[model samples]
Target: MPSQPDSSQLNNGSSAHRTLSGGGEMGALMRTIDWAKTPVGPVEKWPHSLKTAVRILLDCRLPMYIAWGKEFTQFYNDAYRSIVGNKHPAAMGISAQETWPEIWSTIGPMWVEVWQGQSFGFDNFKLTIERFGYPEDCYFDFSYSPVPDDTGNVAGVLVTFTETTEKVLLQQRLQASADQLTRIFEHAPVGIALLSGPELVYEFVNEPYLELVDHRPVIGKPLRVALPELAGQGIYESLAQAYETGQPYIGRPQMLLKRGQPPTLQHCAFEVVYQPLPDQQGQTESIVVIGFEVTELVKAQREAELANRAKDEFLAMLGHELRNPLAPILTALNLMQLRGTSEVERERTIIERQVRHLVALVDDLLDVSRLARGKLTLKKQRIELAEIIAEAVEQCSPLLEQRHHQLELQVPNTGLTVEADPRRLTQVIANLLNNAAKYTEPGGKVTILGERLDDEVLLWVRDNGSGIEPELLPKIFDLFYQEQQSMERSQGGLGLGLAIVKNLVGLHGGRVTAASAGKGRGSEFSVWLPFALATQAEETLEVIPNLSQPGQLRILIVDDNMDGAEMLATSLSLYGHTIQVAHDGLEGLKAAQSFLPDVAILDIGLPTINGYELARRIRQLPELQKIRLLAVSGYGQQEDRERSLEAGFDLHLVKPVDFVDLNTALFEEQP
Candidate 1:
């Protein structure tokens, strides 16, 4: 430390300095001070050097504060007033410790150095200063230089500073936001890329985007340079268009070719969109590309289409081949009814029942074909639902008995009516019952319940059987979807029954749904149909007797199939009728004219001519004008029936013709 200075250097001689008053803000503050109460005492009695330093501080336009004497009293110009907002005049006369006590620990050392004649200068120095009764972090570019007295000894420290708190804080906030954005770019699930310049140079690529390009190096390179394989692909052109015209482009499942390890082009399908980014002048500057890879999904869809087509072709062929022999087998059954003994008749009944089931399976396949082509037509009418239920129960009775299912029927006897096709409605309920009976174990309970709601009729078929798998339940009604059959030597079905049920219900503006708790827990299927109210006029219905009247007739049968023709002829002959058979259309036509037959039954497929052409030829024969013509065919589509009617046939019978229906047509003549 230096030796103590002379009294003249500390306080200068009393009354030796002039008053420091001026036109500036600090000058105005000095003019209003009560110098007698301050440590510096009255202005006239202050030291000359202290007075000189105060005058220089007040005259300067820069922000300067003075801590004088031992207390380091706080003093500043108007510019520093805004920095220490709201702490103005009260802070003016206080010591540096009292005015900024919270920050004194940081700045107090600097002041001690200045007072010792050692100067200090700091930039961007941080401190927590208590200015508004609370501590706030702030920064400053300041100096703590010694202020010398007249004898060249330090008397005070001079402070010159500029608060850069706001500027520094703004920069920090901007940097934090940038860091946050970088995190989002790196972790986004979908592919994202940012490109800049006319050539669409890659400025950034995220993790997902890197995977899309096989992790190729693309940053800072033009898109074409990065992926030369995409040159002729539409993607490059689309990108250029959006970049140049500033018009966005979106591509869905567009293929992009990239080279792989084997140098072969690997195609990736992506739903990508190119969005233009504009600069301040509203001109295109960059582009943002966002996309989702859909390659697997697209491939799966294409494969599914091919599979469905294969299934459809298989169904058509299966249905056709199955129907061919059904006609002969059915004819044989009818023949056995009259010739066979009681024991043979019982076996004949079994064969007849099985043949009918096989025909139903074939019919269902044909129905599915019609459904796929959207060519099915419904024959809707108003009828009592109870009548349909009775018919369905009768149809499913054999299967129910075979399975030994305890059947329970819950239905209203009358007044429960619906507008529906009688045949289709009966088929729907019958199918549900059949499926239930087939799937149920012996002694399992099967229930058919019906309830009428406000405007809909709900029919449910429930079974306590080997329940469906949970995963299979959702797709139970889909075409050709069958659950795993148990190991009981049972070929339950071809999986078309429920699909037909769904389609039939849909045609009637209704819906069908299946529910199951899981395997071995049971399943229930519900069909909801719009119901109708029965009027008094509809309450009374006509009763038609099912019995056939006995008649003897001269019949001519034509068919290409020998077994079908011979069996049918024998069955009709047992009805006290004279019958002749011809294997060809021409032979049958000649026989019909010669015999002058009462009825002519013709098969469509003949050797030299079709049944249609034969029917036209037979109609032209004036001698055969009185003969009733019945056309037989395997196809029962509406178009087949119409063609038969147009060919001069009075009635069209489907192949494997029901004997009862055929007898009724023969004996009960058209009105």
Candidate 2:
């Protein structure tokens, strides 16, 4: 005899308890009992099955509701109340659709499926339900299965659901992260990919990654599918070892072949990082690989290295070739002048001029090298600016004649002395004058002026020749940059003269500037050099005293080449010296003993005994030791001169030497 169940529990209805457990456990087990046959509901107060189901529902997190067709919507537990809030009456007595109109769309669809005896599932579903008098967006993972009656007909839909808002948001975050990673991988310039197992299957690839290996499809395929040649080249083995040990492998400067009609080799730098992918089980499954293509850079670097080496060798050979022939040429010209014959004298002048031109060219090339290294050293002294100008004018006189130009000079009576390197100063003025003569029209005038300023000396060279174009004037001092007109003709030089002048003048603590109104007008180059105050201006000397005597001196000449030795001896004898010739160093030593000459001019490059050894042995003898030792050879670099001096020679002369200069060096005054 059970009393009626409490009015509060009844009013709350079974839906209240049913909602709490999310329709699982005891609620499901109790559903196995037939409620109609059992002593349940108000008549029995409360049955064991109903109590058990209610308790189980109270503990559930899922929200469940029981709706009697056209009756109230009853929520049994906390889960259902959380969903509906304070919307309905406190018990099962209201229509569900009338209470929550906004959520009817989802409910209507679910009701249709369950009533038709079908079980349906929806994932990542959304529902807009009225909670607390406010409509809110909700995400749910809900499923409904029809509950059948004794006749096997569907009676009600059993719904199971859970709030999925957090999971859905988490999924969105994961997707965003994946998208960002994909962007970085896709746009990367280097090749990037994933590799798995011994097959090295690719799981992902970017644009540059695929294009690197001939643009073959790599995703979902083994690395060998596109790079079968790599196995033969041993790249596959390297990659496998790196993966097995979880170590990274890097290959630098490897040559790879391109995929094309005509394949070309490409140099690439590669890095394979074995990053193991983890599954739900937490295990490494894949590796990532990255690579860089460096073919262009490597090729360019090698080409540049080869070019530099070739240029150095060329310069070394050129220096040797030019210096070698100078000694004999100078000696021959000097002897020719001694003959005092009109024909010989005229020929000697021509040879001398050509020699001077060749010397200037060699000097310029060497200066270029010095300038590049920032090693063009200047030895400055108190020098007469006007005299320097005169020397430069003399050097460029031939060029002026060739241009048929008229030259004029203007010098101040005083304050024309500058603290500068005499040789470099003359070179600067000469180069400017030569350039003017070259560009000026025939019959044009080139005027050189020297003036004294308070702190500096001003030397300006002005030419009424072809003037520089406006655009070219600014860059006139740039190395190897000749004007357009100059390059179009054979008369154009290497364009190093102005550059050398600028550098040399700068080294002397001076400045040089060029200016011209425009083309075909004329040009002016002005130089300002530091000045040294002078008590008196030095007058120009008329003549330098000759040192060599008219009387004869016995001399021995030695050379490997017979023609060269004979030609040299013939020239020396004509200069009032008795000469004996030998074809080799050994023969020359023998000749020295027999001839006993006042002076012995030796060639460094001779057969058998070398120049240094020959000179040493000769100096060992008392009679030969007393005689003057002159080294006349083509090797005339600073090092060569030092070595010759060490070898006991009184003077070391470079080949193709200037006979007049050498004569002045050897004989300060004629005997």
Candidate 3:
């Protein structure tokens, strides 16, 4: 039978071991085991070294155990019992194989080595254990050193250990998270960079950041040294400021210098953010850069600006060319209507009407340009709605008669009054009316009706024309939108009439809506205009009586177009006035000094000396000090009118003006 061999080197007999049978729970359980039947048998007669090792194991706060003699019997302290959990008191004096059967197969060889006087050590040693009902993964750091007998041969093993599963698991999860964050940083689409230390040394930069910096190597070097080209740029200073202040900086469409190949420009744009990264103690330790390239967006905006300016110049030249011919035709018509025979007057009427129509189209195109640029202004005033309705009807009646459409009008005797731009209101109503007539078949019935409801006046133009498609009703007022898909339509238009009407109404704080059941069914376009507070209604004259009268006032006409100037002089001469004409500004100034004309009609854009300078020169002469100056131009912008006033003109007139309006302008009253 095996009695416990001496482990004298590990433990000498002490008063502590002599009392071990009832020292603690493990000790109490050990005494209950029948030790004499085991390999390390007979507890009362056990060797002094064995008793000493057991005593020392039971006193430790750290998990420790002693396996004595050839049986490798288990003797463990209270802390070791907790490590084994519910396998506790029953495991106290059990053989190592019996108490730790789950891991005994793996640790048995190591146990044999320790008994043979060899030591075993493990750090974070893994073992699958079934101490509880289910198996669990456990880790430990432990040492199994040989305990020698009094005969000088190894007789037992002493073990000291710690469970390290929780710490190891936590470290694994932290590493996984770090790897995932690193992957995300590498693939991010925007440029990201990190700079550490007060000297602004570059620490990490993603691929996009490298590309933004012209793919120059920058890691582990200060920004100024790495990108020597950035020495004078403000970007380095911005980064430094963010670090020193601990405040973030954001730049939108900020200019940056990226030196390109020799011929290309050095300017680039970016939207960038710089933020400070703080340390655990709350001091800023680094600067992080986040940004995207905005060079394309900046370039696109500048290109658009250039194109718009070019369009404006083209429009100005186009307006001048169109008005030059129209002026001569209008002046010729005035002479024909006053002095020609019946046949001549009839033909002239047709020419005059068509020329005026072309002028209206040109004016509409110009208005569209102004509307798109947000340059149109409304001349708002208090006015009667009924008068505007009647005038707008008269304006559209020619198209209505030509198309052979029947118009039904509904109005109240007491006029609906509103404060608005009367001219724009008239244009709005007339555009709707003309639009109705243009789309309608000959003899289609159209109804134009207006009524007041609460604070609004609703004007409805319902036409039995080819109606709009239901899907297209909402877009009728959009600029350049047309109901017809065919580019060529019999009813000629630039698709601007309704768009202008919409813009004008909106400017007056109102809206326009179009309703149609479907294609081939009639459409209704309605405008809702707000009614202003009523004041005294003044009776407005709806017609202009021909006010031309024979007179002998001397006049001078200066224009670059010879036909326009001579025809206009001829028309003035028909009224018994002596008219002198000059084809250029220099000739006109000479004529003004010689003829001593009472009135001078000047066209802007004359060669040799433009009209503005001529006016100034004419003003300086004592012979023409009191002469009335009338400025005429195809440029009808507000600035054009202001410039005319500054040039000492008494009045300004747009081209293709009615002869009657010209008469009134020349006399400052009815001629």
Best by TM-score: 3
- Superposition error at 631 for model 3 (Å): 3.5
The sequence of per-residue lDDT tens digits that candidate 2 reaches over residues 291-326 is 767777777777887776576446545765776666
Sort by lDDT, best first: 3, 1, 2
What are the runs in model 2 whose C-alpha is more than 4 Å off? 1-300, 315-327, 365-390, 397-425, 441-443, 449-459, 471-496, 499-513, 526-654, 664-671
The RMSD of every model to the true structure, in order and in angstroms, is 9.4, 10.6, 6.2
Candidate 3: residue pairs that collide: 36-42
Q: Write one digit per residue (lDDT tens) for candidate 3, span 430-536.
A: 99898889888899999988888899988899998889887788788888788765566778777888899989999999999999887778889888989877657
Indicate whether candidate 1 or candidate 3 has the larger TM-score.
3
Q: Give the TM-score of candidate 1.
A: 0.59
Predictions in order: lDDT: 0.81, 0.69, 0.81
Model 2: how far residue 586 lies from native, Å: 6.5
What C-alpha lDDT, on a 0 to 100 scale, does residue 490 get in candidate 2? 53
Per-residue lDDT, model 2, residue 465, is 76
**lDDT value, residue 342 of candidate 3:** 75
Compared with the true structure, what per-residue lDDT tens digits does model 1 show for residues 381-478? 78878899999999988888877789998988876778898889999999999888777788899998889888999999999987888888889989
